[model samples]
Target: LTTMALVPQVRDAVDLPVVAAGGIADSRQLVAAFALGACGAQVGTCLLVSEECPIHENYKAAVLKAKDSGTVVTGRIGGTPVRILKNPMAKTYIAKEKEGADKLELEEFTLGALRRAVFEGDVKSGSLMAGQVAGMLHEVRPLRAILEELCGGCRGVLERMEKEGF
Candidate 1:
């Protein structure tokens, strides 16, 4: 499941720890995950723009410029949904899908799209994979700074919750 909607149900179904992934970009989301019965959170898109991330600057810029509505889930033509930024390449793919493009056609279009974005800095014609939480990210900070902010925010949130009787 790509959503935390399943976290509570899964946690209640078995005696196992649940790690939530997808759309978890900030400390508030982390707190929400815990409230939803998740013991841990896996962050992905948030790191793509990290200072330590080796992705091309174009990819990072695309992510940084994105808004909450900037991402779209394509790849249904290939039977696997992938969330990516709404760039020229994604728009073309979406248009093709709307016209009932075949799997082979979709594969051909997306082939090397990610590589182009990551290595060649072709944001317009490349696949910039991101999550809905991308808009929550603003800058490319160092890993240490990112971690510290998250932890500090988490603490602040916990303190507020405790004081407010949440």
Candidate 2:
């Protein structure tokens, strides 16, 4: 079955629950996923800044430093455009996007490398997988604050969307 078809299959395969991964951010996205048959959604990029995250300080710092317009999605180097913290490696890859096959040199840059950067403090050669939503965050809030805020937003949305007269 196609990836699209896997959702219902996986959801039905287990009695526990299913959480959708990839690109999910904010309370609205979470709610929408559930509305689409998911029990919960996974959020990786948004968690980069939680006070207890294992990500390196520089990685989180880079994400928090990102601007609303900072991220770029590039597919020129035979890889999908993944949201990431802006850094020298990312910048260079973007600059080479126009070079076509010449840009294939960028393959040397991988998400695993970024993980090294985010998890091992090797900013020079690590890939930092993030989401465009990183722009929405400002500081390293505690885990409780993050959950509370998300829950508050979800509550507000649910309350506002409650049935007309009921």
Considering every candidate listed, which one attains the maximal lDDT? 1
Q: Worst 10-residue stretch by lDDT in candidate 1?
A: 143-152
- Over 47-140, each residue of candidate 1 has an lDDT whose tens digit, in order, gives 8988999999989998999999999999776689999999889999999999999988899988999999999999989999999999999999
Cα RMSD of all models vs. native, in order, equals 1.6, 4.9
For model 1, state the Cα shift of residue 120 in Å.
Answer: 0.7
| lDDT score, candidate 2, position 98 | 66
> How well does candidate 2 score on lDDT at residue 61?
84
- Show how many residue pairs clash in every candidate, following the order shown: 0, 4
Measured against the true structure, the TM-scores of the candidates, in listed sequence, are 0.92, 0.68
lDDT per residue (tens digit) for residues 1-166 in model 2: 2223555678778886777765455777666667657877777777889999988998888788777676766553565666666667667667767656343356654536766886787665566667777888889988888877765688666766785442
- Model 2, TM vs. native: 0.68
